[model samples]
Target: MIQKLSNGFKEIMIETIDKLKSSDKRIALAKIAKTYGDGGQTAVAETFHVSRDTIRKGSYELESGFPITDAFQARGRKKVEKGHLPHLLEDIQAIVDGQSQTDPSFNTTQLYTRMTIQEVRDQLVLQKGYQDADLPTNQTLNTKLHQLGYHLKKVQKTKPVKKIEETDAIFENLHATHEAYQGESNAVRLSFDTKDRVKIGPFSRGGKSRVRVEAADHDFGQTFLSLFGILDMSNEHVELTFTASKVTADLIADQIEAYVHKLRSQQEVDTLIINADNGPENNSRRTQFMKRMIEFAATYDIKVILAYYPPYHSKYNPIERVWAVLEQHWNGALLNTQEMVLGFAESMTWKKKHPSVTLEENTYETGKKVEKNVMDQYEKMIDRAKGIGKWFVEIHPHQCKAALYMGLKTQ
Candidate 1:
């Protein structure tokens, strides 16, 4: 076969011979001997640029195959740290499980020590008395660590709020108010809250879009857009207002005022049930928010009922689900300017109705509050439910409206 081989075949074998090892090299020579039949070894050695004696040995071995026990025991590169580098695996585990044994945070099962592969290699050499040559490459170490169930992961927040004793009672009150509003034709239940603050400049948002856009390298405290939103549960209507100011009590009150006017213009809504979280701006105990709410009730001739969810339960709000939809809709687009942000928000549809977009360029000052003495006089109109007063409050139009209007008139 070697004598019959073309020059091209001989050249290809010469190029590949250096890459073959052990049994592979012998197998190539044995195949040539089988093809040649006689003087095959000499013909193969001369044609393929190999020693004649080496080819003869391979031919004899091919003719008389050895037993399984006579074959080589091991092949390939040896293990990196053969002699159990003395507590190396245990130390790696210790570093990977940092502070988790004593202090744990949120809903993550895996603890991260934030140690790199190079750091691990250095630690082994410096502390464990292991030579540099014995340590495997970083890639190999990473694979080994993964095999041992250690991985690099970010921390997640899953810890719930401290269990409230009156959680059931609060939920019941919320349900009763919802049902009451649902049954009344003159009532409007609006889920009132602010969405996550978005930075004005180019920033990365979650999700994929058809068009590719790049975000800023860092999210500095540049300009930001605050969304004060209200979702009417009765008609599934959404009202979103954009502001460049902090989400304060004044801002919340202003948003409520606009929402009230819009609803009254469309139909008769004598009662406004506002569902929201117990955030600082809209807290039941916030005197400023209470004062503004009473005036809001008086101006619109509508009774206001504030129903707050338990702490850390903001996800239960109906508007929260709408906000989630809006987030998903614009996640892929680049919101580099306020116009883009507003455009994306207006384009997103929830329940087949696009939200009414209003730009509130009104520069609202933070920390604006009514005097304690004046607020105390109007507090009489605010009625709180017994035992769970902080979670429920009712502001009657007849009670505080006169006092609030009088005060405003004097101002």
Candidate 2:
């Protein structure tokens, strides 16, 4: 019966490893090593036909409390195209030359070829008069094609339906505003956006580490956390706030309120220019968020200029880059608790400076739309750009609401 059970376990291991991706297979095998103890490494190695050293390394990773998912990374031999395939790149490029999109308007030089590696091989063998022995296998040919910058990519789902005529003009305006704000001593320029949502519990994330760490078996939706971040353009300083509750308009407004208040304590900020994309929670049409912003400008007695980037271009916002750096900082480590997540974020450096992290435990109500009557009063304080109103706005203090129209620069 014991022998039968051991055989069943080996079958299960084989089946499980077959179903998993490369990194995940290592993690699963690591877990099994941990459970079996002393001879666990040997048992797993024999069952899986992997070297004992690989299993022993996994076991060590499990004990060390780091991540070992990428332990076997770059383990295989270099691709043939890198060294062995002398004429492969030139030959493949010639075949796909006609498919190149030479249009200057297109962002990239996209190839339109749909031929498979086998077809390519046949073409080289028959037309190019190369012997079958001289040609590499189809798999190697495919890798060679990729090394030559060819890919079998699917079309993007969200193609721009129509070009916004004023997109370039808006970007030009943003550049001018940023430069103008930077020139002033008492003025501030900031980029605002929400970072990638993270699950609060221990979960396996993509990255490589020297040791392996165990995470939760499954990811549940309820444990996710949203982070709203603001990047100070002048000093390269970042501020982060964590919200277990959904990222709502009111929440964004509150964070802005807190940020402006903190700035007021440091210096007498005259003009505040903020750059952000038109996200759902803080768009120009988001009355609640705008209402709070207008109130914030008025209370701070500063002129607030909201410079929005074009749709589907969140990368233009400087805050997005900050999030990328933070993600890399804690990619492999297991963020098991709220404190762990906050600690990791606080520890990440941008321009040799770490950000101040604040946890917003206060839950705000979602889908809270402002009343039309209240919004109408607030609208008078906001002046949007002509033809590109969604991409730009100026909010004046309550008392100086008429300032919205005074120097409205639509250029």
Candidate 3:
């Protein structure tokens, strides 16, 4: 019977003969014999630049008829000392199971630190015969742990805020408005909001380095400020006005006026639709002021439409999104002083990646306090009316007109 050579087996036999002719045939034979078991043939051939058949032939010559035993003995690299494979495996299992009881997520470092070599040795002495056990070193344990798919990491739990009931309505309104603006040739809808009572300057410091250096020297003081901004949906222009007080309807009006004038300067039409939340300022006891604002807008043939998002749904506001971006930019990091805070705040500019409207800090004098009567009137109107228009029309009897006037002159 003729033995038909498998693919590349003849080439391997020729290569094995070449190795046998080398100065150290025994060493070469041992290497070739090692390759026969498992998937070692390809690896041995690549390592020694020989063929698989050459390795197979040399392996056959070395073992003769005791193929199974010879191949098993030649498998992998020889262990210089083989004292306790079973004991080491047990120790590792014990450590893993013990840690799993306390913290199922315990990583390799935690395991290693918690289970010392002496402790493991003691446990082996008690559970099994230590004389026959070969304890693994920390490095070996770490490698083994990794091989077992154990790794160190920080597990974090995320708690996202639940969507309020009003969010859907607000989002719906925003989408409708956005679609309407897209269809209109020249009409623009601007979303405006304020970051109220944001402390300016170095109100807080963060980071490990900052914490160490400014541990005792840091001065924590509050510098109240407001960021009033308008986002023009048409051209994506953002106009910001910074103030040093609580945001009120008057301030909102002032910003709107400035925005309108700027638009007019750019030859843009004055037909603007302003959207805001139903805050006290928006529905203050300023009927005359609101009326004037409306009449003034009418004079310019500009229709002022006020859109209010539902209660507890402020997050639905586009301006709220802007604030979120700003907050992310300034999150947890501290500014050393008011100047630093202002610089940092002013330094914030929008880009295509995180597209935002730019806000410039304009230091306006505060001390402007809204009267209790105005608030009371606003409360009454809000209480009597339902939905968005209730406050503007019912809260303060004549306040909407007054706000209009204030908005017009300011514009």
- Candidate that scores best on lDDT: 1
5-48 per-residue lDDT for model 2 (tens digits):
68777677588786976546666677876777777767777777
Q: What is the Å distance of residue 393 in model 3 from its true position?
A: 8.5
**Per-residue lDDT of 258 in model 1:** 75
Total clashing pairs for each candidate: 0, 3, 36
TM-score of 2: 0.58
Instruction: Give candidate 1's error at residue 365 in angstroms.
Output: 0.9
- lDDT of each model, Cα atoms only? 0.78, 0.76, 0.54
Best model number under TM-score: 1
Candidate 3 worst ten-residue window by lDDT: 388-397
For model 3, how does the per-residue alpha-carbon lDDT over 88-202 read when each residue is reduced to its tens digit?
6645566555643223444423332345445545666677665524555556655665554444434445555566555565556556656666746556677887775565544
TM-score of each: 0.61, 0.58, 0.44
Q: What global local distance difference test value does model 2 have?
A: 0.76
